[model samples]
Target: MLVTIVSLWAQKLFRLDEPQPFGGAELQLTLLAKALVKRFGVEVQFITRGQGPFEIFEVDGIRVYKLAYRDFPPARTILGSWDLLRLLLSLKTDIYVQRGGGIETGIVGMASRMKNKPFLFMTSHSWDVDGTHEKNRGWIYGTLYMTGLRRAAGIVTQIQNQHDLLWHNYGRESLVLPSAHEIPAPIPIKKEGVMWVSRCETWKCPHVFLRLAEALPDLRFTMVCPQANSRELFLEISQKAAALNNVTFLPGIPFEETEPLFATHRLFINTSEKEGYPNTFVQAFKWGTPVVSLHVDPDAILSTRELGVCANGDETALRNAVKQMYCDEGWWKKYSENARSYANATHNVQVIVEKFYSLLQSLKK
Candidate 1:
């Protein structure tokens, strides 16, 4: 008698809240889901919270399990941790990946250990690791956040600096894995002016973009301020943009719908205080649009690689960069090509996804 051996494919589950409106974390999750399904034929599941009834839905070829809740508290809180613990216990997943750092991640880490499963942590922002954010400033919160990070089987950081910080502060090993970018097919259209897209958060500093618009009176500036957790900030930015003739403010649209805006934009502006490899940067690069950033430069690639302009948090430098890009067409084209080339070579979804797959496979051993 002849016997045949059977092989099994791995099932990966991601935990986050509301996969819609695609913020950085959500975009990563969505891109990972697509890559895993298309490339590796892995069974991917996303667990999220929603206002609707508890249901499983398919969005863009991924299984999304939305837990019905009136309002989901931050996972670091007592109630939030308890809810996360209960939910995590109910599911049997081969590997659990969490994108944000908080009490919820700690609770999930604990649950993974108890269930004999591997938990992979992805640092979403600088505040997630540096302990500078308000949530991680206090000793109690810092301890709690670190507890989960420490429990993770492996940690993924977006930049080398973050990896070094993790090792120095938490004594944990991490892999520097930048977020993946899906290069959109080029559209044959005339792209013009400058575009800035972000949530209306104080830390994101939309006021800086508005000031840039003020400085460049002749250039058209389009601002997309998505309403997230801060309604007041959204209104403030909206009212301010209304006063400027060169500035136009748009309410948030679905993340899938923003490709055209990026494709047609001459440049992308980022005014965030800090980031863990911003999705916007990659998005801009994929569309052959250069980026003019205030502070974020993952690996100093902006300045060193000439992907775009990095102001190093200098207002004057940032203003000059924008003006230079606007006025000099040939210079702008060079940087734009550089942006696309760098993104295609380094942050392509296929390349990053393979890295992620290898990392997850290593955890199984």
Candidate 2:
């Protein structure tokens, strides 16, 4: 008699879909899901809440299931959890992953535990781990959020500092999983204007980019501001950009379009006061564009790897770095090359995705 062994396959589901007014977390989710399906043959699904009719759709090879909710926030979280729990049970998801810190994460965390399935939390921003975001600081809010974080079967952090912060503040251990980037194909570098892309939030400091554009009237500066939680700030920046001749403002486009956009620009500028291993920096490197950042460097890669100039949030230093990169072509070329080389070796999607897959498999045991 011959006996054959049957292999069991698992399906992973993300608790949220690519958010509207998309940001790094949404982009990361989309990329990771695509990589999982294309490279590893893993089945992936995204659960999204909407105010319209419930529907299911597919985008870039991932399944998206939409559930309708009536109200926002407090009620949404309560109702959304119920709907999500029902879907989780019916689909029998092997593992559930929450991409960011939110009240819903706690709800899902508890549901996963009750169902005896593994749940993982991935931190996308520094504030997610450190509780520095204003919303995370409230007593009741912090307690509820931390409860879910603590119950998670595993947590993933993009950098060592974030892992350290999680352990120090919440006593939660997390695996250090760096963000991945898709390197663009060989294309002629345009070497033109300075580019900035971010939400028009006060913390992001879009005004700093405007200031730099004013200082460097001879060089062209372009900014892409996407709609985010703060519309007033977005309008404020849009009005500010209108008054400057050297500066051009473009509405945010989809993530797929960002690589070519970055490739056309000679330099990338980051004026954000806080970050958690920004996806923008990784993309800038992959596009062969060097970064000039005000603050937030992960593991000192900017200085040690010679990827770009990191001023550690100093205004004068940021201005000087921009001037130097704008004026000196030879220096900019060297930094740009270093950026691509470093990103290729470190942020390659295949390598990072493989690491993520291993972590998922390990959690199964």
lDDT of 2: 0.76
Per-candidate local distance difference test: 0.76, 0.76
In model 1, what are the clashing residue pairs, if there are any? 75-104, 76-103
How do the residues 233-279 of candidate 2 rate in per-residue lDDT, one tens digit apiece? 88988999999999889867666667777888888999898888888
- My TM-score estimates for the predictions, one after another, are 0.89, 0.89
- Over the stretch 1-365, how does candidate 1's per-residue lDDT look in tens digits? 00000000011123334322346876687678778888887777666655446676675566666655545444325654565577677776778888866555667678878888888888878777776643546665666667778788888998898898878877888998988978766643578989999888888899999999999898999998877676787788899999999988887766665778888889899999988788888888888889999998877889898888889899999999999897798998898889888888888888999999888888853
Please list the residue runs of candidate 2 whose C-alpha ends up more than 4 Å from where it truly belongs after superposition: 1-19, 69-74, 133-136
Query: Which segments of model 1 are wrong by more than 4 Å?
Result: 1-22, 72-76, 133-140, 187-189
